[model samples]
Target: MAAPARPYRIGTGAGFSSDRLGPALDLVRDGRLDCLVLECLGERTVAFAHRDKRADPAKGYNAHLEKRLKQLLPLCRAKGTRIITNMGAANPRAAALKTVEIARALGLTGLKVACIEGDDVSAIVPMSTPLYDEPGTLADVGLQLVGMNAYLGADAVLPALEAGADVVIGGRLADPSMFLAPLMHHFGWRADDAALAGAGTLVGHLMECGMQVTGGYFADPGVKEVDRLADCGFPIAEVAADGTAVITKLEAAGGCVTPATVKEQLLYEVHDPARYLTPDVTADFSRVRVEEIARDRVRVSQASGRERPASLKVTVGFDDGWHGEAGVSYAGPGAQGRGELAARIIEERIRKAHAVAADLRVDVIGASSLFATAGLKAQAAQDVRVHAAMRSRNREDIETLLWEVESLLCCGPAGGGGYRGAITPCVMTKSVLVPREKVRPTLEVMIA
Candidate 1:
């Protein structure tokens, strides 16, 4: 395969579901990218999408998909930049249809929106399947199974790119693979080439989290200060044919891409430097080099990998019911004592008065919430908030828990004020593995 004349430029538009859109818009309009990747699926996020799908048939994709496509699609069309995303959390087909609709509305005729499906293996994966992370089977979860999706690799996305897709979308597409696929397609890197696969995978890993490499999460007030952080820009990868690349951001934008930030994101969530497993490859970052070529530009190279994993991991999501939290603040000289008293009062009242048999916790937020489970004591503070939280299969139990916390404002501790309560649905997740051959990815492109 022949290499392209120049390095490919790709940028991350989003890292998570609620990432900012302005920075992405900046990348598309000014960064001069060939492709933009928006990775927007987490285990719980997919589970929530299932819940939304159950509520409304056309509502399973990313909530920000419309707004993002509305702004990004036109610019991407004008700039000739392709878009790839996993924003199709629970429904890629629906997301594709929505994108096509948005394109039509924007008068972007002949836009090719591709939807990749078949990541979902809920039908094939049995309840007897063992969990990968902990001891237990899917049946042991004892909650309603929402869905399960296998992580699809770059091969799954290659077809859409080859078929000339303007936008590619899928559910549960492996995060790095979205970035890796374009590199593979553009550079004609073979799937069996472990060395090149590892190189492309490294680029994906660094660019997958959007702003993380650009110092979005690297900001520490004094120790790791990032300049103009409020206007932090997303990352751009200038990737060469040999898998060498420069990690950079728009110089006109905020934040800095130093070796420290690159190294921090390199080890982010990585368990082993030599064997970081993904659906695409078992990448080795141990010998990878990070060098500063210039301001806001760090050249990365020497990433290698072994063959891909034999089995693909699946995220099994279950509906765990409701989660409720309520809090009351106490101020003045004895605020910490009052807050502690309020916590105790709510705990006692919920168990006795409500007879609610549920998982519950009460904490003095300002003084001891985080360290209470560690059996450590916190110093006294004049202002404190008593927070009570619980989870239950029954909505009534959550409501009961919230009532007791609010009752503390008038019935128990003195100086208790600022009472607040909220309830939300909860989903639990577990990991399981399936044989590679059993999971297949399918792609279809729709034109607008």
Candidate 2:
């Protein structure tokens, strides 16, 4: 494939699992993008996806996949924009099938949707596998294994693009690689070209989080004020063949893309600036340049790279039982004191009365919740909320915890009102490494 004379334009649709759909639709309808990448999966999200797949084989992909694609497909098809996404979660084939059905229902005849699989390494990894982040083996977790998926890189996605897939969906596709694959495919970038890989990875890393670089997460009202934040737009990357990109958003969209926003996102999840490891390359963003050339447009360049990692990281998902939370707010005089008293009461009830041996936590929000573990305490405020939460392998234990907290409405505290409680299934995740050769990605295109 020859590189186009003009820059290759791409944009992000959804950043996280439940990211707003309006911004994505805005980008697709007007951004003139060659491709739109929807990065929806997170570590815990994949774990929950496995749990979802366990309960119902037809489920497990992103919960909003249908809603996103139902709106995105026709617009993208009409605009001649390809889509690459990791919305497949724990099940790529099913997600692709669902896409086919949606496309058919929309009267999108002969639309090609590629399903990429083989990220699941549940059978490939053993119980004795040592976790990369902690000092424990998989067996040491003592939780039911939900699933294990290796991070598939641009190499795994390139074949589908080569096959002319309009939409490419996969499980555990590396976040950056979703963006990198399209660039490499469009520019005919060699997999071994570490420098190009680094540049592409840089573009991916910046754009993968959608609006983060466009001021959605960068807003600090009265400090780093963003105008019209309620209408914040997703990011767009206009990439040159050499890998430099100008990160910008729609002219009519809200939010500003200044150097600060770009810089914050550049180092968002990077533990090491010189060696940010993705499946595609070891990106070196330490000396990357960020230049705000125009309003709501920043040019990022000088990102370099070394060889890719020898092993691919695998996210091991486990069924972590249930999590319950209940909160009661208080206001006016002595509100802080009442909230703190409520927190203590709930703690005692869960620990002593219920005798539930779970990981229980109580916090007096507006007083000392966010920084409680850091030993930082805030002065008492007139408005406060007593929040109690717990996690347990047994559903009954979680229920008891919730019940005891709700009982505070009458049993304890002077004015405990505005009570809210919820119970949700939980999932835990761990990282492990596997030889890259062991995980083989397979691609199949389904037409609708």
Put down candidate 2 lDDT per residue, 1-448, tens digits, no spaces: 9655799999999999999999999999999999999999999999888888999999999999999999999999999999999999999989999999999999999999999999999888899999997898999999889899999999999999999999999999999999999999999999999999999999999999988999888877679999889999999999999999999999999998999999999999899999999999999999999998999889999999999999999999888889999888888888888888888888777778878889999999998999999998767688898888889889998888778878888987787788888999888889999999999999999999
Model 2 collision count: 0
Provide the lowest-lDDT 10-residue window in model 2: 346-355
lDDT of 1 by residue, 54-88 (tens): 89999899999999999999999999999999999
Q: Report model 2's TM-score to 2 decimal places.
A: 0.97
TM-score of each: 0.97, 0.97
What lDDT does model 2 reach? 0.93
- Backbone clashes per model, in order? 0, 0
Off by over 4 Å in 1: 1-4
RMSD of each: 1.6, 1.7
